[model samples]
Target: MDRIVVQAAAFDAGAEIASLREHDASVGAVAAFVGQVRDLNGAQGVDVLELEHYPGMTEASLAAIVADAHARWSLRGVTVIHRVGPLKPCDPIVLVAVASAHRGEAFQACEFVMDFLKTEAPFWKKETADGVSRWVEARERDDIAKQRWQGAGADEATQDKATHDKATHDKATEGTRARPRRA
Candidate 1:
């Protein structure tokens, strides 16, 4: 069973898990992830967030992601729920759950589904903070996370390692720089 829901109403993650467990007797493990709205985003104080998505397309995209996860793992069931519309801090945003006959498959499939959802899903988010509103930009880290599953070429991995090396070196030397001290 693959259950995908995109709505504005809040869903109970606990109930969703229980439902999946009851769906199959052969299920031995279930893994899940819940994303929630936060009060702060980096240096900004977020007042509220509005999520928008193309109705039919959004559901179809989610289904595709679930299908990919199923193909990669031996999952018995998958459940995904994503909320849209006005949401305040601490509100639930999304949920991804997977059930399998083994713990490893369930865990990997759950993570894979979320990684793809964050980068591939067609959901736009507008954040209002400090009398300002802006669309959230896609994070590079999310892209990198998704790339791990893409079988990225060794050249790309080498470049990523070099970038990480430079960042680490810079950080280690940052504190050694001379700076004006407060009187």
Candidate 2:
């Protein structure tokens, strides 16, 4: 897994995918997606989009997400890039690619990686359009959506819930087995 930034330079998504597949002979498939700045966003027509992130923290967050994908899926390679700074319309904003031994894992891991990047990574968007520049917020739904990624390794709350459930289930099973049939 690798994460990078090209500053003002544009990235080739296809080139990134090729690099991932070229390294491993076992890679049977590669899935990738690129997001770009659009000319219009709903009521507002986009002029330019600026992305910002806390330098070291941004990279760390993204690297952790890729690592999570490796742990969750049998992935061969993953590459991600989320541009920072001003981007014109049609300029690429983000790139994600996944390679695996099978197409299923490749596709699913690609989606998983992209989704996690959207919600988990701390990238802020400032869209200057419709004569307004506003900061984007992580939607309430974004919070709820990201909760699905909260694995047992993520927090004590989830681990605690699993432990509690396990203990309750074990006790119930033991009690049921210990009770003889009433016949």
Candidate 3:
């Protein structure tokens, strides 16, 4: 079954979790997160939140995030659902769930999918408050959270190359200081 869903209709989180579990009995642990629309935005009271996304681009981005999680962890199943259109406070915004043989992989992969989705996915949010609407910006903390996965060694080959280049440069320039010389 496809693991990514982008829709305007609301989804039942409990049902979604059950579906993931039923699909794979070998999954011993399931970790999930459901994000909701908040009533408050900073100091202002939020009346509604409108979520918009680029259709194909959004789905592709989400699929890539899920694939990245699978590549980094031993995952049995993954579910990512993101809602679009107008939503009120307490309405579910997103869901990220992962199933694995152990709790650690499920927990980490669930978090990884969400962190990347928040920063990497092509979703735009607009908040309406006091008859005014404004687009929200990505949080710095979200970026920092996503960065933690970079050290997972997905780019170890690239890192190795950088290290090799530095070593080569150091060896080539060992004890060499450039100075003006007389012709």
Scored by CA lDDT, what does every candidate get? 0.82, 0.73, 0.81
Candidate 3 or 2, higher lDDT: 3
Q: Any residue pairs clashing in model 3, and if so which?
A: none
Tens-digit lDDT string for candidate 1 (14-82) = 999999989588897899999999887565665889999989988999999898887766788999999
Superposing every Cα of model 2 onto the true structure, what RMSD results?
10.9
List candidate 1 stretches off by more than 4 Å: 41-46, 152-183
Q: Which ten residues in a row have the lowest lDDT in candidate 3?
A: 174-183
TM-score pick, better of 1 and 3: 1
Please give the clash total of every predicted structure, in order: 0, 0, 0
What CA root-mean-square deviation does each model show from the true structure? 13.4, 10.9, 13.3
Number of the top candidate by TM-score?
1
Whole-model lDDT, candidate 3?
Answer: 0.81
Q: Any residue pairs clashing in model 2, and if so which?
A: none
- Measured by lDDT, the strongest candidate is 1
Q: Write the per-residue lDDT of candidate 3 for residues 61-161, one digit (tens) a residue.
A: 99998887877777788999999999998999999988877665677679888889999899999989877999998799999887766754655456446
lDDT of 2 by residue, 92-118 (tens): 989888887756556656776777778
Which sections of candidate 3 miss by over 4 Å?
A: 41-46, 152-183
